[model samples]
Target: MNNAGRDTRQSTRFMLLYALAAAGGATAYVPFLTVLLPVRVADLAGAQDIAWLAYVAFFGAIASSLSNIGFGWLSDITGNRRGWIACGMVLSCALLLCVTQVQDLTGLIAVIVVWQLCLNMMLAPLTAWAGDCVPDRQKGLLGGLLSFSPALGALAGVVVTHPGMASDDVRLMLVAAMVVGCVSPVLIMGAPRRFPELNQPSAIDQTPRKARDWAALTPAIRMWIARLLMQISEAALFAYLYFWFRSISPGFGDNDVARVFGLVLLVSVPFSLLCGRWVDRHNRPNLPLVVGAALSAVGLLTMAAAQDLVLAIAGYVLFGIASAIFLALHSAQTLRVLPRPEHRGRDLGIFNLTNTVPSLIMPGLTLAMVPLFGFSGLFVLLTALAVVAGLLLVALPRPK
Candidate 1:
């Protein structure tokens, strides 16, 4: 009983530290990628800014996808998650500083590709380390804790881009420093001995991961598809939200949309935390995802049905809240459905595809949908996708 009590405390502390690290990881890239990357491209590319931004995004996504898988497999083979993360952080920060020195677009792309490779070297393993440490019973709360990452990341962007301080090198320096600060504490501390040999760095998992072992992931596969669908919508809104709001009210400016966007994400924090606790307590994990998707579908529908500014904003608020929770909770639940502990890092890197693929798919999807049927048409299509995501989760077999 005494041992059990100690273990519980250790696990709780681990979750908190892990959550901080997750937020730090987001801080590393979110500000730079979202705000600074385009600014850099525009400064270098001159009049071809749009073309340059597209190329950078395309190459960056490809690099992010491939490197996440490669580095994750490396970590798995080496049987050390933390070591790789530390090395990756240092190298990526060095590369991040190098980002300030690039004078041409070609050089910028080259640097970004390498930086992305090193960045995922940290991210992929950091993600899998949580799976190694946290048990299924706590994944819901773990995910809830992780829900803070993106919000803080957005806030970090605001911080690095403050009007008073305005040097590209200085901004990059702040980002690199923030990454080190947020990720260092967890790296210094040791992993908890909460699970069976999970924390041990002994040997590679070289046994062939067979087809039969893969069969156990039917639910995970459903989750994969559902998450992809939800992300498609989220990515679309992420890309075109400003335009959509501007369409409703031509008076809407970038600052207006940015403020609204950040606020909506901030609001999701309490909802996700509360829902995460509820999910852990009830163990009906799929239900919340289903409900969140359905509500998001309604939100999209509301976007279509009410094109007026007030109703559109309300619709977006609902969609943003629901989508945020679904994404957060689904991330934790994905760990529960993974087949083998040994391959957790690699499989998670595969899951990381869902994050990057949308950028690829949504741009083409939005262009195809919006030109034909207008923003209303795109909203309706997104509504359909969100519904399908919900139904997929509904089909998942429940716990006995």
Candidate 2:
């Protein structure tokens, strides 16, 4: 092929790669909101003891974090990200399908925990794949593509099919998983090979090469910490957003709440892509992150104090825009800081801990705070988390 032809083909391939990664990521995240899904299921079934739902959610969180670390390390050793990614995607489908057979809460929680564990194996590696091969200049666009997660999750939230309707969640879950899972491997199959020799590097090395590698890796590490904190705030607020809203505005129903999340997500998509593209163009990842955090804090504080549903919904929109920007920029920014060309999977795995850790911590924190200060107290705590996350980014050494 001519040079121009070659360039066109390469651009096409990268676009495919971005789509596959985004699709697979959406599948992984779609099931994560199952906590909310089950709540609807329970309400439809006329079951009570709502607290069990939280337990199931916590179990899933722990499993997800553990799997992220394990599968990530495994991908590092194998130098084959697709193998594990495909496995996790398939396994999550099976577990999600099995969940349909459960009639009791124990069965429900058990299947969910297993499904979540398998699910993370797909997620941690899939996300790492982008960092493994994509150039730094494209990180922003990668973030923009990632906005598909919430969009997909929101769509999944509205189910014409439930368990009573022949297990709609499973049907959608399997279809989405298969499509995304199959595409993931095909897109990355031609990714430029790196670290042909898969030997483990010593974490103990003190050589200049090792030091340089460590320094290069700090941006990802610091961003991971920031993600963890931001997620803590986000998770805490989401975990109890309804309760908080109910206490302040008891009349709000499912339709109203759905509208709130929907509008917020709608406003967020463009903002997410815009921040990412701007950051890529300017090479200014940290600035967006700092601004996003501050904006999110203001929104959270507004939600905490608002008495009118309109104000709360407005707050949610602001929070969603900021959160979207934060999520996109942080992911792309981490790619810029990865140290080793060969071990992107390993480092990105560690980096994903920020995403998973808060899912585990936020629930407990939310529950503990409820009795002490109630819903209002949760927002104050969320603001603190956001502020700290912003401060951490500010403290990071300038990216080279």
Best by lDDT: 1
- Prediction 2 TM-score vs. true: 0.83
What residue pairs are clashing in model 1? none
Mind giving the per-residue lDDT tens digits that candidate 2 earns over 1-400? Answer: 6975444222546545655556556545543353344444455345343355566668877787778877877887787777887787777766665655677777777777888788877777777766665556667777776676565554444432233433545555554554465455654464543322223343545568867666756666678778988888766655555555666688865445544655566567777788778877887778888999989889888877877877877777788778877876677777676656456666676676677677777667766887798766887888888888888888776545
Among all candidates shown, the one with the greatest TM-score: 1
* Model 1: per-residue Cα lDDT over 104-188, one tens digit each: 8999999988999999999999999888888777778987888888777767777777666658899999989998988998999
* Deviation from native of the Cα of residue 114 in model 2, angstroms: 1.1
TM-score of 1: 0.88
Residue 19 error for model 2, in Å? 3.6
**Global lDDT of model 2:** 0.67
